[model samples]
Target: MSKGPIAVIVLSHRDSEQVTRLIHRITEGTNSFAVIHHDPSGEPLSIPPSSQVAVIPDPIPCKWGRLSLVQAQWKTLQWVARNVPEFSWALLVSGQDYPIRKMSAIEQELAGSPYDAYLRYFRVGPDPAEDVIPWQALTRRRYLYKRRVPFSRRSVTLPFKRRHPYRNGVELYVGDMWFNLSAPTVAAVLDARQMSERMLSYLRFAPIPDETFIASMTLNVHPAPNVAHDSKRYIKWGRRQLHPQIITAEHLPDLRASDAFFARKIDRLAHPEIPDLLDRLAEERTASSG
Candidate 1:
């Protein structure tokens, strides 16, 4: 198979026990392995010393909806690009994410495909950021200038605004933070990001830079036709909510119906049965296909 062992990058902060379990579960089969970047502000991870998953020795401090999160992910990707160069495809996901489809199925899909990356990329340029894409309104709010209030963690969107910043004034793209990319494509993006001085500066104050950084860099360097516009993740956004709704057993029907390989925002404390249900469904599907 052209696609060999999968490299999974896990960005986690809370729930040490669950995070360690997630690492073991993802790396248990198909020779896949995970490297984790745990935010220092949260509880320290407790992965076993003998575990297959690698931990970043000095993880960068991460803040929600800030450039720090993007930087953390970039550092993690840098490690994978250097160490796991033999990976067929690399998946960017959070520790809370759980696979809905069987690992074998995901590998088969990656091996037979020729796409450089799998992600959601929609242009946000040439005009104002209103209705430029399906998710334009929310996206515009994310890219606009903002300032953190003094003595508090809160930040407010400033009235001053300009187009998304780039050194070359090229069109920028925005999409989900999670992505799947081939080995070569991952290298290309890492290079592009390293060379982006202006964009990096702008992102230092931008809200949720991770959602926009990787997509813009990937689409700029890679041919659009060879890139799939889907991240293949099942995430449920709640009305007027800051984060995605927690996945539970009630979401099983939708998860089973979708072609998504993984689902997110799983709170193990609240929905202990969700993972078991996913395992059962994966086995049933594999059995039926066989």
Candidate 2:
């Protein structure tokens, strides 16, 4: 089957080596494009030849893990949209993510399909208490009880002046942040800056703008039929924690049954099964296609 060019945008803080390795694996036998957004303060490293690496200027004095990282990701996406022509779909992979399916299988599944897989859930009018606030507040406590931490003292806040109260009986659904977006969706997000000053203004204060912004905009602009409500990425939440628990060999059964295109929070140092798992998944995809 013929395939349109796919753009893989890797979001990383200091893991250039890991990102490079993933790019190598992804482009092994296909005409794929890759862009790495290396945080300015990350360790110095060389990007392999034939790949595009954009390093954010150092000393930007931005938090490595918060909304700043999301901003960096948006910038990288904008760059890809402008520089890479004929790009059909954009895959947003983190430094810690590993593919559980072969690129061939993924391409075949997505061939000529306009739907993009992203984590989406339904929420009633009374949005979840946490969702209303920016992500930084929930994750980093950037804004707590009207007081800001030293690092977040001057940080921009989300547009919501006051937190919306959620009624006790209302149900809320929240899920993963990672997503695979179509070119048009990507373009729409990039264009959000131009269309809505309110959104662009909210970027600074909206702690985890990355998670909320795209999902909110997509829900508002795109038709419901075009959006993949659930992204096929395997993620396990830790004990009362926000981030997904690390993936280990013990989770292999669930991963296999997940029908997920990728899995995250892999322990590269401790979990040696990762590479083996990827290999097995690739073989499975090959056999299925043949």
Write down the lDDT that model 1 would get. Answer: 0.77
Please provide, for model 2 over 137-220, each residue's C-alpha lDDT reduced to its tens digit, 9 standing for 90 to 100.
353333222222345634544445534211233122233456677776777766656433444354445444455545555555
The candidate that wins on lDDT is 1
Give the poorly placed runs of model 2, Cα more than 4 Å off: 1-3, 51-65, 114-117, 127-175, 194-196, 222-225
lDDT, candidate 1, 1-290, per-residue tens: 35578888899998887787777667766767888898888887788875568888799988777788888878888888788778777898898998877777877788888787899778775456345545666566667656555445666888886545643645578888999988888877777654456677777766567888888878777444378989999999987787998988888888878888788878888878877887787787778778
The numbered model that scores best in TM-score is 1
Q: Enumerate residue pairs that collide in model 1.
A: none
Stretches > 4 Å off in candidate 1: 128-134, 144-164, 167-169, 193-195, 222-225
TM-score for predicted model 1 compared with the true structure: 0.89
Residue 237 Cα positional deviation in candidate 1, in Å, after optimal superposition: 1.4
Model 1 residue 6 CA deviation (Å) reads: 1.1
By summed lDDT, the worst window of 10 consecutive residues in model 1 runs over 125-134
Quote the lDDT for 6 in model 1: 83
